[model samples]
Target: MMQQSTIIIILLSLFFLTGCWDEQLLKDVALINSQAIDYDSENDTVKLTIALVSGNSNEKVPTNTTIVSAEGKSIRDGRTELDKKVGSELFASKNQVTMFSRKLAEKDIYAALDGNYRSPLSALTARLAVIEGEAEPILHAETENKPLISDYLRDLLISAEDTGAIPSVNLQNTLTTLYDDGQDIVMPRLKTVEQKAGAKLIGTALFSDRRMTGELNSEESIILLLLANSKKGAHRMTRKVQTDEVDPLYDYVTVDVENMKRKLRVKKNELGNFEVQIDLVLKMNANEYPGDDLYKRHVIKRLNTQLSEELTKEANIVLTKIKEANCDYLAIGRQVNAFYYSDWQNIKWKDVYPTIEMKANVDVEIIYHGIIN
Candidate 1:
């Protein structure tokens, strides 16, 4: 009994004393906050740029920064070359953003991204975006009065989320959607604009089969938000309506819109065609209603009908644009897969998708008169 107790005590002490075998200290590791990748098709080489964070506390003292660029035939080889250029081990655990040139995304971003996903040090939650021009120029742009470039990129994504124009796609989400059969992927397309001091969020990149097939402009992106039911917070919608007792010109009402919700449904017809039904419910506050004492119930009814018609027209226009782009921003296939699994499997979605019919029914309900009837 004494011998066994002594042995058990010795094992516990050994276990407690044994620290992490492969511990990496913060001082020893160079933290990468952002990475940009550019592919040169002409030379069949890839260039990678890593942005390292300089933990300098003194505001007056200028901070020292370094950019390491490497080229190789493959992404892994390029990364190895970058490691050699940096002299220190390239740690990506602190990486917050990954950017790819449009040319690279147009070719295929899977292999380049695969290496990041496979590495244990790389963060799966890093935000992903596509640079409009060369990756290196955007990566090494001069930072004048802003925070770190990585933090700025992160803020750009968060601001886009607030606008409801583009949905955030992190590294993990991008890969999962790229691999999923029922759905496709999309990423925010960023470009350095002359308007907002330096950079701006232009639009979004539409992906099909892990390759960028098309792009959605700001208006088209808003339409995508409405169709996907991803819009949140306040959105501005304007419509012109004529009053019931209208004499033509002087009876127009221009309203500022708020509180919008959209519900979508997918169903298969008897003729083996997919039909999408969209029900849009929205409320409007009266901003500019012409004429004195125009609170008649029938006037409100007529205005609602007119608003509904206009909303339907706008919705169809946006849907048509998405269809033309060959991008399923609404995830119609996902709905079909969830509801009609057998039909989805038997049908070639790519072929059937373009031919799918969409019917949008918009209902505008007036809940408030903005403290004035």
Candidate 2:
């Protein structure tokens, strides 16, 4: 009798575990791959768009792709409006990219992103980008060739980060930087171009106070990436140095940077003013060093001097650009907070950030010359 009771209890437990109460089959659900948010300034409404992947596990090729959009006074409201068309609850757990329209970014995106931040299903790791034009076009363009636009954007962002063109900023990091008192934020700026090849990532957006303050060109964006310590892969540095009597007047040297370390020091001057000093240690391998003489002290010194000068010049240009844009990408305010907490409290970071004197010293070490000496 006890054995029979045990078997019956086991059968009942198995029956209770057999059903997935809140789970839907793959066929019954639409997989959301990417999302776009746009602001209609004239209509004073927020537009939310989602891209749904149309493919089955057994199918070798995707049948089609679909983009659905809805507009309302807020992001949540816009999502509710989208329910009218989707007919099912939206799921963002698989979302890979989130594109914000320029208009929406220009007006403070905090209110628009409240829904994403509050939602339990939303992904904090989703890649964020600022769309140059309309967000819907990016979601809709080349849908036939690219089954899912979100996956494409994700790959593009990963490539961009590897190439050091833009710093990788996910939803969580962006929000943290924006909310932190000692730092500002930046996002990859993406634009679709009319080219025979196809669309591509163009630039990056600079943000100040949770708004789109300006944009950085490709080169400037790379420099910003380096300054922000976001560079992960190899970055090439080209410098022209005046040669001696044996070589040409100028020889171009291409350096493959392997590693870079940056240290920031903030201190108060005797006059009570603040000064910031940046020290960078870089390790590099020479890709193209045309000089016949190798391991010469003068040659190394000359190369070091030229590299230092060029790097300082580039760093100053980037700093000036960010200052003009009114975006503090370097997080100079963090230094202030670390060294002079009391003074930072008395002074407004934005007001005094532009006036702070900065000095940069870069030291580059040539570790190798490829396979050669």
Candidate 3:
């Protein structure tokens, strides 16, 4: 009789644990993949757009997605509008990317993203970008071979990072830098091109204190990332060095950045202003430098000198742009505060950055050629 009672109790326990009591069915919720936010200047409101998977996973095949937009006084308000319109539970745990319009980014994206990061279940690691114009259009842009706007843009950001064209940025790290006094931030710049025929990743957007300041092209961006010592993967460059004016092909040289060593120092000058000194040595492999004798030491020396001068000129131009925009992508202010606490407390970083004198030098060393060399 005791054994029979024990078996009956075990059967009852198994029955209670058969299924999850609070499992959310896919058919009852709309899964959000990507989102865009724009500043409605005319109405003084915020516009929010969301691309979500249709809420019919069990009912039918969900090949099509529902792209919708709503406007309200604030981001959360707009989110509420979307949820009411969709008429289903809005789930965004799988969100891939968040795009901020140029206007919103320029004004200040720190406030615009508050709704996204406030939730503990938010996709904090979602990649974000500053659209060159209204971010909505990119979502609707025509793509013959691409999957969707969000997927294409996410892949583009990954490609840029792989080539060392932009620093990897996500919603979490951005918030940290946005609040930091010493470090500014940078983001991927995306734009629609040719009457919305396609979208392109033009370069990187420079930010100062969470506001977009300026931009740098793909080539210039790689150099900037290298200077920051944030190489994502393989870094490659194709430059038309001053090799031969007659042979246009010979003017082009391809190289791979194998390694780099950067040093930054901050010192108070005699004029009582901060001057930063940056020195970088880049080791490169000569990939395509034809029409020259690779076996001869003298020829290699000339190539090295030419490349060094050219890269130095480009690096200085980049530094000038950074100063003009007052974008501290290098985190120089952080270095100062960590090492010179008293000096950091006295000087306002925003004011000092624009006028701060910096001496930047880049030297290119071609340590290896192909096997023939």
1-373, model 2: which lDDT tens digit per residue?
9999999999889866766667766656666788889888898998899988776678786656678999999988987898889956678877898889898888896786777788777788899889887877787666345455676779889887886777888877777787877778888888876642234777788878788888887766766676777657676667777656766634778787788898877888898887877777788777787773547777777787788778878777777767776787788888788878889889988888777777767788777776655
Scored against the true structure, residue 94 in model 3 reaches a CA lDDT of 75
lDDT (Cα, tens digit) per residue for candidate 3, span 1-373: 9999999999989877767756888768877888888997888888999987553447454445568999999988998999889978887777888999999998888878887788766788789988888888777766666646567677878777787777889988888898888888989888888788877888888888878988898788887887788757657888776557687898777888888889988888888888888898988888888765767888778777887888888888888988888899899899889988998898898998889888778888888787875
lDDT of each: 0.76, 0.78, 0.82
Query: Which regions of candidate 2 fall more than 4 Å away from where they truly are?
Result: 1-22, 56-63, 143-147, 195-197, 238-252, 288-301
Candidate 3: Cα lDDT at 138: 76
| Candidate 3 Cα outliers beyond 4 Å, as residue runs | 1-23, 55-62, 243-247, 371-373
Per-model TM-score, in order, reads 0.81, 0.85, 0.90
User: Candidate 2 has which clashing residue pairs, if any?
Assistant: none
Please give the lDDT score for candidate 1.
0.76
At residue 174, candidate 2 shows an lDDT of: 79
Model 3 poorest 10 in a row by lDDT: 55-64
lDDT-sorted candidate list, best first: 3, 2, 1
